[model samples]
Target: MASKNCCVMFMIFTVAIVQAVSYDTELFETAPCDSNACFDALHGALGDCSCNVDTIDYFNNVKIFPRIQSLVSKDYFRFYKVNLKKECPFWADDSRCAMKYCHIKTCSKDSVPGYVDEHENERPAEKYTKIDQTACSTDEDHNPDLGYLNMTISAASQYEIAKWNAHDSALENFCECDDRDADAEYVDLSLNPERYTGYKGPSAHRIWRSIYQENCFRPKLNPYESFPYVLSSDLSNMCLEKRVFYRAISGLHSSINIHLCSNYLLSEKGVDFAAPPEGEWGPNLEEFQRRFDPSQTHNEGPNWLKNLYFVYLLEMRALSKAGPYLETEEYFTGNPTEDEETRAAISNMLSVIYSFPDHFNESAMFNGGSQAAKLKNEFREHFWNISRIMDCVGCDKCKLWGKLQTQGLGTALKILFSSQWDSLEADPEQGTLPVRHKANKRLQRTEIVALFNAFARLSNSIRQLENFRIMLSANKEPEVKRNVFEGGGANIRSTKEQCSSGGDKPRIWS
Candidate 1:
């Protein structure tokens, strides 16, 4: 009897050990790393991309970040044309952000550059002629007789110039948003930055939930399954195109969260907004940990951080591929001096980006057997749908950025996988220039501005991660506040009433 009991006990212990091992394995495969481990292990090659994450972090942090920041601050990149009033098509809810910070200040018509506002047909040829004439007049050595040679050109030449200035309508198929809407207004992105907007709860959650559930091809998992388990299983079997699509969205989401954390409104006490101008804004260490620390976020933080690097490489690859076109493309904004400076700045930035050793290979993607074309089209359509979904974002500032970044990613996809390459190559004369130059006239000015600014935003997020890491290591939690508003309870009561009515709690801004 004793011997039989021992045998049964041993068998039970063995089954329990097996189950424990399986659980551990699943956790490792899904989460992969903790905060410290992620920072240390961020060196390897990223999924499906040729570049190393460590290399990206180093170059972007040290060499490229400052330049890109400066580039985006320029006139040509600062003003963005977007239809902020577009209604949400997904749901009937038209909720707006209650926070004052969520509002975006639109540029007055007179504030926008004249050249940017000019129609293609009315581009004013004299502007180009004046620039050329000014340069010739300033030159020390020039033939007196050939001086100021006829500023006028033939009709054919004028037509060619106008064609060059006009945006390629075909690229619109890649992006779903109607950027040319007559109702669209110019918003100075410099004035309105992406940050903590007290925009959360059911409304904000619905936007992301819909995006992930509807767009990403993630399978429905068991209700009892852990998030890590679901994440691991879904990514394990997905094809390259699907994974790229998923990662791109995840990366963008991660970038936005990082921005909010970096620029959180920590205190409203005693702080005088009128005196200092800007509100009390700085990094919220506790918020960062809550969102990204593995211990706090159930091991999902590292995956999101990794996806952010993937997006940086993806956009970097696009910029590298389009180097030839970007180098020669004009950044005219009605000011000749600033335009020349813009060109030189872009040229220098491209040179530094081109120095990177390995880049994401655009050609390796979409090579899946006969279904390749179908998969490519599906990928484009899915992204197009995402671009449209941006219109549904309730917060004005959030929608502005959501549209810009999605459009930027869509532009990157077009550069990577579009069939326009074949048409460009078919012409012998066009083929004489490098293949990279094929994007010269294909991309719109808005798309170009969106692309570079979006990458700058991602780059800033990556750089800010270090600041967050240091803050985390300090291990100090901020003191609890009685209220977010000044004068404690009285102001808090009024603020709550302004945000909502009837006794429903207002969404807290951390």
Candidate 2:
């Protein structure tokens, strides 16, 4: 009995330790750098890695995607075009780009006082090294980005440049040996101008007509026979679409880097908006105090409402761009003939799907019963395409790419059970106005019930991506692939069953 009790205690302790450990903790530990480090270290490494046009051309052909995906998400590579220009120091003529204006003053090592030896020969004496020597510099010819890029590229083992590699320590060298591939290039922008001269802003599509007329269409079939041949719009349009996708994806990702999305995930139980104190107007304290007495009206409603509203708008815009691409029959099913274009579109879609939840998790504040129902309808229509992609591309690895679409829908469903929708909409000053104003602004109870039902259906359709990743990682067998999609419904039901025990209460962001 004593031996049995000791064995039971040991077993319990082992299970407790195992349960306490995180699956991702080890995965991240082996990663070259954390997310935060990637921002600065990668920036610094790229600065060093940027060589002249020749080096740029060489790296453009190199394949790093296969290596990058082992640790980092492949979505990061889409920014390669912008990164090539922004991160790399480009000189049309690398030789002429000089920093000859810089002048330096140095102290001579022999200038230190010396001690006399027995043979009357002067012996050198030790002296402190003075690093404060002033150096004259002219800003007229200095390109700091180029200089830094050159210096980093000059280091060995840290980065790979044209005939140059950084020989720095692992910690100092962000670029590993596997990052280098001197062979064929994976990205080709040879036809499109390296830079888009048109209004390259968030709303790039608006200037598409102007861009096409000026830069895109003019190269081909010029009246003058002397003009060189130009590539058709086939590649150019893809590049433009990718640019829009990149900007859209970057905007959403920037929010994550800012730590605005630390709390929201599909697994989260509730989302509570940070309600600001009532009677306080943003940006005008004096006007707020004069217009409204603090004692009369209620203070502190949902503070995150305004931010969540903006996030919703941004999310909608991103989804609008990504949705059409994913919906296209050709893109959903792989194009065997035009594989590159299909792959690019698929990559963009993945970025879009991945970023949706990051922004959608904050969207609980803006959701109403009707909105939830519409989302549910969209999810049913779209889930098949998403699932098709997952089924074809290893469902365990790719399901999250599809399920990210319905996270907001699930949140909407959960929130409807205990909605403050009526209270929020009834307040005249709450600024619940839509883009277009209407006579009937409030949602009906039937719509709310429909929304709850919709969310329920959508929620049941997909399972947690993180769980799938863990399962797939643990079980390498091919049988698990089929089991994953089928098993998703079972897991969703189980999760719902657990949540039902808590009375399906709308959890507010705490």
Put down candidate 2 lDDT per residue, 226-299, tens digits, no spaces: 11112122214322222222222222112211111111112112223442221111111111111112121111
Error of 2 at 338 (Å): 12
Tens-place lDDT per residue, model 1, 178-282, is: 455788888998788776667765566556655655566554442322232226335656677677777777777777777776776666542554533345566
lDDT accuracy of residue 441 in candidate 1: 45
Give candidate 2 regions above 4 Å deviation: 1-79, 83-309, 329-510
lDDT of 2 at 503: 9
List clashing residue pairs in candidate 1: none
What TM-score does each of the candidates earn? 0.73, 0.16
Q: lDDT of all predictions, in order shown?
A: 0.65, 0.23
Quick one: best TM-score, which candidate?
1
- The Cα error of candidate 2 at residue 153, in Å, is 45
Give the CA lDDT, 0 to 100, for residue 473 in model 1: 60
Cα lDDT for residue 119, candidate 2: 21
What is the alpha-carbon lDDT for the whole of candidate 1?
Answer: 0.65
